[model samples]
Target chain A: MSGTPNQGPGLRYPSNKKSIYDRNLNRTKNAELSRAAFAYLFIEMIAYAQRGVSNVGDLEQKLNTQGYPIGLRLLDLLLSRSSNPLASIRPTRILPLLQFIAQTLYRHLFGRPADALEKSSTEPGQYMLFDNEPMVSQYVSLPRELSSLNCAAFVAGVIEGVCDGAGFPTEGVTAHSVGEQEQGKDAKAMWPDKTVFLIKFKPEVLEREEILGRGGG
Target chain B: MVVFALMIISKSGGLIYNREFHTGLSKLTSNDYLILAGSFHGMHAITSQLSPAPRIPYITPQNNMLAPSPFPNRPTGIEVMESSHFRLQCFQTQTGTKFLLVTEPQQPNVDTMMKKVYELYADYVMKNPFYTVEMPIRCEKFDRGLDGFIKVRG
Candidate 1:
């Protein structure tokens, strides 16, 4: 093992110029993606889902699962992309993570923030993440066998993972298809398939959910 | 146009899907639907064989393909049904997979709708790791997509 400067996998960072972290995070924003790139990427994503799913539901879940990593990666990417980016991506509290996911991640993926993040009235450990429509499963269909499965569960898993990774242990996350009404159709009345990603925290997460929920009350 | 319902039948023509959208059309017995699929399958094979021998289209004079021409003037293996309520169009993918769509006959862009349904089938139904081909197709994503597409257009 020659002790050469350019050889071997050692903890060597870039020298000379300012390190990436040394620069103000706000400096890096407004990267552009070509429309065709997004279209092709989305098409390939659909094709990948198509070739892998055993059923419609499984496919959607796969898409959601795919998005989960994006969500996780987005948590940091958005910060790095932020006009006023953070110095070190320190999500000291759960609220910031959810906000980043709902706003930063949502806008990055859907061109807008999620509609809302609400607590389930019945379930104490549960929180609902809302979107008018989920993009990944936008054109998916679930077969009969998967009538009970929720593809959004993948998103839920992602959120849970993020939460857990960030010192917030959580239970399972589930996506419940809640229908949307438009185009002269009462989608909710007939088809309640709008996805509501249920984020159920672990006992620890529940404690935090309570701590967060009891902000005023 | 709104896509009301879609059914995928096996090569044997077994009913693999029986979903409803907006308003499902008249109900047929599950057994009857299976019979219908099988009968339709039998008819499809005959029609495909009966399709005139692949006369090489002037477009492809080279005749590069050794096997029977993929572009035989074969019937698309598509069928349709119409009632005052809705029009049903059957579309077959290149892989001999079938997609039946129920929509309003007067719908301006039914073809696009059918194509989208086919796309959804390929995406959600085909890509699902848990899904097994040549068996029942049960997927939640497919249903959600159908619900959204129909809800928006219908």
Candidate 2:
């Protein structure tokens, strides 16, 4: 149905009479927002998430929740954009999906692929995605009271969303600053902002992967 | 190319967001917007089901081989509706979120506009930590981004 002649209450038109629906999505595809603007927005996000939080863990969890939906949304958006429509395909296995995240997703968001992707030597379903200098936390300097907090948990949430959205469900994804935990001082100094995203898929996902691997081969 | 309005419906047929840009159409109350979205979702489902089944390609004895189809699964819903005054274009994401754009009947590149709206939704609404899934969007950044893009470019 069309609208009445009178303007609806609460309907605020832009000064130029244009709305968001009129914008083109591809206009910003190659354009980059200013780093300062991004930093300011990120700082505001962290501040908003930090309010009324008693513990660093809770604060990080809030940030993670914030990033989770983003990851989910990005999964579909990136998948559609990366492949040609005629031969479009999505990652069904673990390795290819992880590669998609470490490469395509990373490059899309950060302008660089992740530093490394490593499976845990001891854990069955755990994989580590490393970013040498997480852009999200590049300017974040935690005070002593919240020294344990890592803002990159937001990014970790994104990884978890990608994994979960791709149908490879994960138990949880967490971000940890590994720079301070490095064994050698030289290593620590080299990448002080190194953050590792630990992705642990659910047991059922791994079990399905094993079954598919055996049968498909 | 005037855009009359935009409506975002969640996967389950709930109206999550609705905004009007131009005054070309009759004004509907908020409740009316919900009804319009729900009815449209239902109509879309019916229309999709009404689509004819894929034809069975006959294989001649001399040409028995059928190469796999290159195209992905086709969208099975009503994508565009046109009236004398306005046109409605729907863009449905893989996750089933629907972006509906009401534009002038002769408007060009409505699909592109829908995609851009979807992107804005992804960035400003979905990425905002405070926004709950399937909820009404009240993100300020999305509004500003939408205004800036549409006012200047649309």
Candidate 3:
């Protein structure tokens, strides 16, 4: 510190003498984190969230909360990364936003677009984003007591965050193990961890969409 | 061609980030900045509504077939406000967060500069876990990134 005159009085520099500010955001664009390392960290995160939880639903909610900010952060980061700054455009409508999440956000996080995206026929404002195999919960095996809990609630939280960050406020986003219901016994046996994220937008969002669609804006 | 200042407004019309790079313009109190952001947000909304409707919808040639353009005709509000002294260029994200850049009247490529600013905001400010949504920005990395970018480009 004494040898460097430009150094701040109380600031400490790492051996590399580079701060997060000095690093390029795109440096990790094509980089892949080790799956084992990620799994370890994720296990720790789940363990932390599990403490003092009374029920499985509460535990899932806690996990969801933990992933919410991540979704918010990724919303802008991925948007900036996806397009040329000169000709960049963000999704303003419902379908485009869902497509962005189903395609861009999925690929960025899981190395591929989601398996399917479907608007719920029974509900006007509800949509379903499907992942044939959720990477986060692949290694997670819930005991018989907690079989009702789907660890993919964290991913659902992330989806909720993305929707909320994009200005399409959702009523809530929840994850369910839909493999059993949607598939035959053979299919379910093949991919037991298949999950679906149900995204229900707020009524105001649908109203705005209706107006915008009518106005062609 | 000199850059002057930058202001960021949240979707709810709050001045979330404000910084001055050059010293040419008159200084205003922090309260004035809040008012500026709020009024600017309102003005932007009004300008979009005030825009004249396009007489014909945009069409595109797709697979050798003429089809209506997929892009929505959302009216972008006040994009550039120019005056004798400085030019105020605004870039509004789809989420309605506005980035305002004040530059010298003759400055070129202000849009590119604004984009860089947005990128910095996305990386340093948004990614920082401490940052609350729609709150005033106080990220050290963001400040450093902005300063470095302006020093290089300006």
Candidate 2: misplaced stretches above 4 Å? A1-29, A83-87, A179-183, B1-154
Docking quality (DockQ) for each candidate? 0.18, 0.01, 0.01
Off by over 4 Å in 1: A1-73, A86-89, A119-128, A136-148, A164-187, A194-217, B1-8, B17-33, B56-90, B99-131, B136-154
DockQ of 2: 0.01
* TM-score, ranked from best to worst: 3, 1, 2
Candidate 1, residue A109: Cα displacement in angstroms equals 4.0
- Give the per-residue lDDT digits (tens) of candidate 3, residues A53-147: 99989988999999899999998888776556742366789999999899878888888899999999999999999887898875564555677
Candidate 1 per-residue lDDT over residues A121-198, each given as its tens digit? 997766778866665444445445656555455566566556655666666556777744342357564434467777
lDDT against the true structure, each candidate? 0.65, 0.82, 0.84
**What value does the interface RMSD of model 1 take?**
6.5
Candidate 3 residue lDDT tens string, B62-111: 54475545655678889999999889999988778999998889998887
Name model 3 segments beyond 4 Å from true.
A1-24, B1-154
Using TM-score as the measure, name the better of candidate 2 and candidate 3.
3
lDDT of each residue in A1-217, candidate 2, tens digit only: 6665456777567768878767654453667777657766887788799899999889989999999999999988886665456424778889999999998889889988999999999999899999888988655545556778888999999988889888988888999989554637877766767889999999999999999899999
Candidate 2 has an lDDT of 0.82
Q: Which ten contiguous residues of candidate 3 chain A have the minimum total lDDT?
A: A81-90
